[model samples]
Target: MTTSEDTLESHEVGLAAPPGEPLQTLTAAEADGLELVHQWFPAPLTVRDGSFALPPEPAWRAVVHAARRHLEAMVGAVGRLECPELGPLTQCGSAWLIRPDVAVTNRHTILSLLDDVQRGARTLRVNLSAEADGSAVLHCPVTRVLYIDPIHDLAFLRVKQRGAPQVGLVVVDSIVTANPVAVIGFPSHAEGGYAEPEYQQIFGDGWFDREGRGFKRISLGRLVSTSDTLLEHDCTTLGGSSGGVIVDLVRGSVIGLNFGESRDRRVNLGVPGWVVQQRLAQLEGSI
Candidate 1:
């Protein structure tokens, strides 16, 4: 057995194992064999100031590939609909399921979808993709609003995705300045509906979706400013990424939620995980 100690040593040296075979999609059993699902450690990997200086190309690439692959099932998209019968009119934003039956997103996204509603109501269909290859798309309709905070533009939606496992949520408290972090989201420009992770073809590092299904956008940058107001960064988020999660790949926990970007689109912002915890508490009573 290649114990966790070996894996840790590999991680430290920036060695990346391809969760079993490197043929693209790894079966659940194969993924399990490689301990991709079980391995979550706090390493020194970070992207300071919206740029990735983490080097040793092959090692970082392998590291990034593993990170995004493992989290594929938990990350998803938030589609907008004026009428369910009409299908989706537009891709409202991005979101992730914190709980099996509950999802968190920006209130602005909820409102934006509601704004175009002509009569009765608007709907948010939680779209989850299975694996990085985009084989399966699981649909969970968000029926009711469980919580809402106007100031932070955060809201919790009730989604009952039939078989989704209840995922544990993690938050980082003590802020580390200028640490390289990853912002996982589905940017509108990237067309977060496809999963073409071939950006590796051009850029030696970063993984992006191409003409494939599911828009899982993983961008590398550093935690620019850990403010009480917002965890700002150069993570380069967009209109479709309003409710995406900002995770500390190093710490293996969520640091914040992607909300908006600067007027120049250079600086992206998110609500700190601390505030995320407080808001999440509001849902506990109702859940």
Candidate 2:
């Protein structure tokens, strides 16, 4: 296995992965597989700020062109949930439109938002996409909390939409190791007082705004493992990455929903696509 202390250490100090466990390393085969994937897909890209840096690779360009419309306005930053106790916007996860009027995020994220609402805070907003200069294009409000999955860390929210395109979905029974994938979301510095240097090291300096908030970022990585309910990938993510979509680069379909990461294993965890699809069907039937 090849260890990149720099990469591992960066995530350790950030909220994505706590610092207690030892740093994780990639095996030789996994490292080579990622390099191969990047040859076709290129590296991660920030929506507004790094727009100019997009590579000329034909495959990457084609994928971006095909997926742009569905993703650009559909995936968004779940705004900070209001909490009187915290005295600030508490949760800042990511959410994406599964239907024009419905969105999905982590159950924990919805719980935090609901707790704040129960405490008398009203209005839940989702900043949808940004302009060329990094200004938000829309601030859509959540009209209702549709469903919170009891068995998984998933939740559904109904949002008022102004024609935002929903994502394409695919249910896969099994995922092969080293399958290329991309995670799209807004990754921000975790709320704690972690040093700026460490945060910069993990998230990089370009994806942030003047206020140090994160912009939309697409991180490319490979599938590490999978199970009946979970899909694990090596895609880079931070504190605010919860609820981002895990997209299959080859198929151009959403295969998972990111929720958390394991510090000991060094892989991001997500709700499998099949699980999500089943739940969505159940929700639709119930409604």
Candidate 3:
């Protein structure tokens, strides 16, 4: 009994005794749960990022199908905001849903209309369409300003609706240049001062045709460069294209928003998604 007691004490202290002694190490299950320590030196290791391959037709098909579903949801989330006159006047810029009832858009879209709303003119009604059979069309009013970027041309508004299908914002520490992106939104055909729209005829403004998910246009472009404070690109766009989502297809999320374009419509600028994420944090209570 005394010898057995001594062995027990030694084992408790992580030690082994004489012959027939158990090893001074963890059991198989315990060792399996612990990972071996990895040592690193400053100069040996290099970064190797893993990426997916969708080369095969089946693989790419699944990718496109998923992206299309999100795109259609985005169309339902977008709404046409017109300056509330006796009747709907000129069509303003676009906005996409970030939250169920809250959306982000260009600051210019709501700035001029702010005065009218303040003086009890009328709420800015956002017209959203259904995704099936044109079953219903919703006109939600922007009841509050959520957030606005200081230097970037972006704004967030809360609509008076319980919920709406939304596209998620892809947040990342840094944006790599020359990454391919999809500029998804409803673009206008007008160039000479008016929004002479060409894409909204079949589906109407700010909607997706439920019949075949028709009328949603996507412009392919790549990140040109990230200059000091702006994200530049060479995507062709029109006036009504402002506030459209800049989607990163491979990541399957919105990396930024196309808010402006160069005079030639070649060098477009977008508000990066990181900026939007930061602004949302500041709007916690401002609701």
Q: Using lDDT as the measure, which candidate wins?
A: 2
lDDT of 2 by residue, 1-287 (tens): 11111122223323232123233356899768755543343445666632434435676666666666544443443232222234334335677777666777877665645765545565565666532376545666777888987667778877776564434334454555544677877666453334455444445446555544456777666777776666667776766677778887666568888887755565677887877788888898665
TM-score of each model, paired residue for residue: 0.63, 0.70, 0.62
Query: How many clashes does the backbone of model 1 have?
Result: 9
lDDT tens string, model 3, 154-230?
78888775454444344453665535565655444332333234223212333333222222245445565554345
What stretches of model 3 exceed 4 Å from their correct place?
A: 1-66, 86-90, 130-135, 162-173, 191-216
lDDT of 2 at 40: 41
Cα deviation at 130, candidate 1, in Å, is 7.6
Error of 1 at 192 (Å): 17
> lDDT for each of the candidates?
0.52, 0.60, 0.51
Tens-digit lDDT track for model 1 on 1-287?
01100011112333221232222233667546434311321222222222233334565465565565334433443222112433433455666776667787776665635544424455667665522334565667777777767567667778776574546456666656544566665554333222234222212223323422225555555554555666666554434556777877556577887776543323567777878788787668868
The collision pairs in model 3 are none
RMSD of each: 15.6, 7.0, 23.5
- Where does candidate 2 stray beyond 4 Å? 1-43, 49-52, 55-91, 118-120, 130-132, 163-178, 190-202
Deviation from native of the Cα of residue 287 in model 3, angstroms: 2.4
